[model samples]
Target: MAGFLVSCQSDARNATRIPPTPSEKLKSNWQKDAIDALTNNIRRKIDLDNSYFKRARIYFENEQYDLAINDINDAIENKDNVGDYYLLRGQVNRELNNLDAALQDAQRAEALQQVSPELYILMADILQEKKRFREAQNYLNRSLQMAPYDGSAYYVKGMLQSRIGDTTASLGSFKQAIDLNPRLLRAYQQNIIINNRLGNLNNALYYNNLALKRYPKDAILHFERGQFYNALNKSDSALLSYNKAAALDPKLTEAYFQSGSIYLKWKMHDAALKAFEKVKNNQAEYPQINYLIGVTLERMGYDDRASEFYKMELEKSPENQLAYAGVVRLQRREMGQYSTPSAREPAQPSAPTRILDTNRVQIRTIQPRRSIDMGTDTTRKVIIR
Candidate 1:
């Protein structure tokens, strides 16, 4: 079995990751100083508008969209005349998936004479997300006309093209975005995703390398690299990348799940169980996690423990065929039927689970668990984030 913490070989095929430079670390210092200064100014009741906006930008950059929205709201409350405030708030709302509110905010910014290439691009993004492709294309064209060299405009154009099922055009636009601004992270990400989906693993790896050079500390990039490596059947490299991703961000439960999957493929049941347990502890309801743990335990001959997890998985995902199979096998075993069932046995079809019904008892809160949507195509799409 491969060691879980094993370092990747410095081989040409592996494309060794570069360490982040000292200069890259220094970039956060200015951001920290700016946030501190803004906080102090806000506390002193001085220039609340600018201070709140500045702090809000920091929050948005840090991916703290809720905190950013609160600050932007305060900024707008202090001075409603600022178009930039609405624009920033619209961006925050866009990230939060509040498409209608984001559109309203963008329109408000336009009414306030804040019409810029960025505003147009933002509108296009919101429209594309809403599946208003025609309107999104119009806005995107306007943004490009305003600032043809704008990397963000091209990024939005690429996203719009992708939504419209124009993967080739989207790839071209993404390349243009990268040419305009090599530091545009989203462009590289889109390129990598599209290339991988097109079965161009070499191109995907090349883009992944470029992105890692610029964003060596980004955990998502590492996780994506691991996926690419896994797709290429470079299991050792995939494992190394997954381990690096987990080390970079322990809360990234998907990395652990992927690592466990690789271990299970190798029949390293103990290692797989350890990795799956980490995912379960971090995110108990992670998709297929309980079912996978049950499989690992069953492989190790712990039928009782595996049966418990299989039932737990069934409770969470009624249509999980593998979990259902485990339940049947273990239940049969309990009845003294030691003969193993065929692995190729088809699972019985299950009734569709009702998510919500107005005629039923009015439950105010419902925590939905992720489940397989059997109706949808199981094949991966190029339109991933």
Candidate 2:
């Protein structure tokens, strides 16, 4: 895994992700079941052209790519108005990790004279994925011409701009995406990251707040809010946000870790231990939690126990150099040479961990995880600070 901590985002041009609304949600489950039943029935009986294509749409929506590909392939075999079939198949192919196939299907769709703004967007995604930056931008331009108000198109444009390191243009494109579609969650996330990278703290916070208002129950959003506040050196606000994130999603290790990190920095060992404890039992995916816990114990005068945790941390992360150092220091202290290592060879070194860093735990931006949204082609990281 890349470092959980990252510097974070810039500007964007990419496709837009369609946000689900209340009415959409209502039909979602019913439609999924209805479509599954209908498609299966259609396949068993007539398997008509329209039936195959309509079934393909349901499969696509529900992410049944394999079934969707089969249905669309059947739909395309008949030859009339097969453009949409080709486009849908191209998208399904992309989902199946068949990039070349996706490109070919898209080309076929365009060749069938079924071109639309959506087709241009799909072509752009394939080109961008293939690393054809210039051609990708051209397709994006074509898409905008056909459907300038398309939110997803604006997002895709932003993604391309950001990929090429055009921070200013990327940021502008992201802002446009949000303006066009207020519920574009990823766009809001990008704004927070980019504004922070550019030292536009106020703008970053503004985006954070906007996201929270729309998604108050999303723990990740609240966790991000904490990181933003911490980065701005607003310790109290950071703590509150972190606490809220933990409350909303008790299993969110990052939120607890952040809260503990703050308490540790403030010299509240008890509080820090409580936070690190949460991380310790939470599957141990994180890199530094064990190390931090050891340090917190040591600070609270539990030298022997602290040494054990430190050694455990080293066992988990052999690269944690500080764990080695902490072990050495604690050993020397036990031998009545607290100030320095013994001149003679000492006993074999053990490990220790509890962040094992300076007095302060650093706030950091985590690299954004893969967006996975159909709109997000590339990736970025989030700050953990």
Listed in order, each prediction's TM-score against the native is 0.70, 0.60
Per-residue alpha-carbon lDDT of model 1 for 1-385, expressed as tens digits?
0221121122212321212223544757756756666677678876667668767888987778999999999988988877788999999998888999999999999999987888999999898878888998999999989999999898888998888699999999999999998888889999998999899999999999999998898899999999988988999999999989999999999999999999999988888999999999999878988999999988887888999999999999999899999999889888978744333344556669968767877758777988876796668676867
Which candidate number has the best TM-score? 1
Over 4 Å off, model 2? 1-114, 163-166, 217-219, 243-253, 266-271, 277-285, 300-302, 314-321, 332-385
Tens digits of lDDT, candidate 2, 148-167: 99876887888898888898
lDDT of each: 0.84, 0.77
Candidate 1 residue 3 C-alpha distance from true site, Å: 58
**Model 2, global lDDT:** 0.77
Worst 10 residues of 2 by lDDT: 4-13
